[model samples]
Target: MNRDKVTEDRKKLGDFGEEMAKKYLINKGYTICHEKFRCPRGEIDLIAKNQDDLVFIEVKTRRSLRFGEPFESVDIRKQKKMIKLAQYYMNYYKISQVNVRFDVVSVLLDESWDVKEIKLIENAFY
Candidate 1:
């Protein structure tokens, strides 16, 4: 495929993965606070709350694990950026008393955009 097509495909896959992650979280009794939360630093794919805990979720979607596991794509720099964004979000919302956690949701999408695997990692980072 051409570059544009590849980019489009990736974006579609990512969207599908995010939708699956949202559903999964909801089923696990999480309240969806936001989707695609963004700031000058970066974006957090999903923000949710379970009771008093605020969750910052990073969704990584992959067609295949030929390169590596989907969560492996989140590098240290990316983690730092996500943390900063989470802090900004918390402060902006004036959520002072809630516990905070970073999570990783890895979705493997099939050609038809069906989720083949969904892995949820909680407390993934400090």
Candidate 2:
């Protein structure tokens, strides 16, 4: 109800959604490299590898889409920050000769913490 409580609730919901997303990716044959990878610029929700390709995924979770879809929350500035963080991660890991892509996972949750919808957008941005 209060602002802090609302923020905490949203954070919890987002964490839950990220866990579900990680499991979903694993089921789809993606090896999760990291969760909440952070750099000075920004943070990436999930970094995964499918074969030789590295995937940078942004997970957006919401209770409902009354205002807009979860994926719509990722704006251009966020994308640029994520890209910068991904580049930093790549350099830090010394990973070369691997394909890279950006993806978005939109998660919709119900009151009972049940996932109502999970939309996976592959190659969502540059």
Candidate 3:
């Protein structure tokens, strides 16, 4: 496949994973606040509310584990970026004094694009 096609496919997969993550969170009692929150710096996959805490979430999806588990991709650098983006989001919305949490949702899909497993890691970072 060409680069464009590959990029498009990846984007589609990401969107699928995010939708699944949202549903999972909703079932677990999280309120969806935003999706694909972006700024001049970067984008956050999802922002949600879990009772008293504002949760910033990163969804990572993969069809296979050749590279590693999806959550493994969120390295320290990525964590820092998420933190900055979360701060930006809060400032943009004038949100303060609420408990904050960082979370990672890992979605693994089978060859047919069916979800194989979904894992939620709360407080994945500071």
Top candidate on lDDT is 3
Per-residue lDDT of model 1, residues 24-115, tens digit only: 99999999989998888778999999877989999999888798889999889889999899889988888787799999999987766777
- Name every residue pair that clashes in candidate 3: none
**lDDT, candidate 2, 27-123, per-residue tens:** 9899998999987877899999887789999999888789699999999989998889998999989988889999999999887889999899999
Give TM per candidate.
0.92, 0.93, 0.98
- Candidates 1 and 2: which is better by lDDT? 2
Error of 3 at 5 (Å): 0.4
Using TM-score as the measure, the top candidate is 3
Evaluated at residue 55, the lDDT of candidate 2 is 98
Off by over 4 Å in 2: none
What's the CA error at residue 23 for candidate 3, in Å? 0.5
Which pairs clash inside model 2?
none
The ten-residue window of minimal lDDT in model 1 covers 107-116
Better structure of 2 and 3 per TM-score: 3
- With candidate 2 superimposed using the best TM-score fit, by how many Å does residue 10's alpha carbon deviate from the native? 1.6
Q: Residue-wise lDDT of candidate 3 within 5-124, one digit each (tens)?
A: 999999999999999999999999999999999899899999999999999999999999999999999999999999999989989999999999999999999999999999999999
Compare candidates 1 and 3 on lDDT and give the better one.
Answer: 3
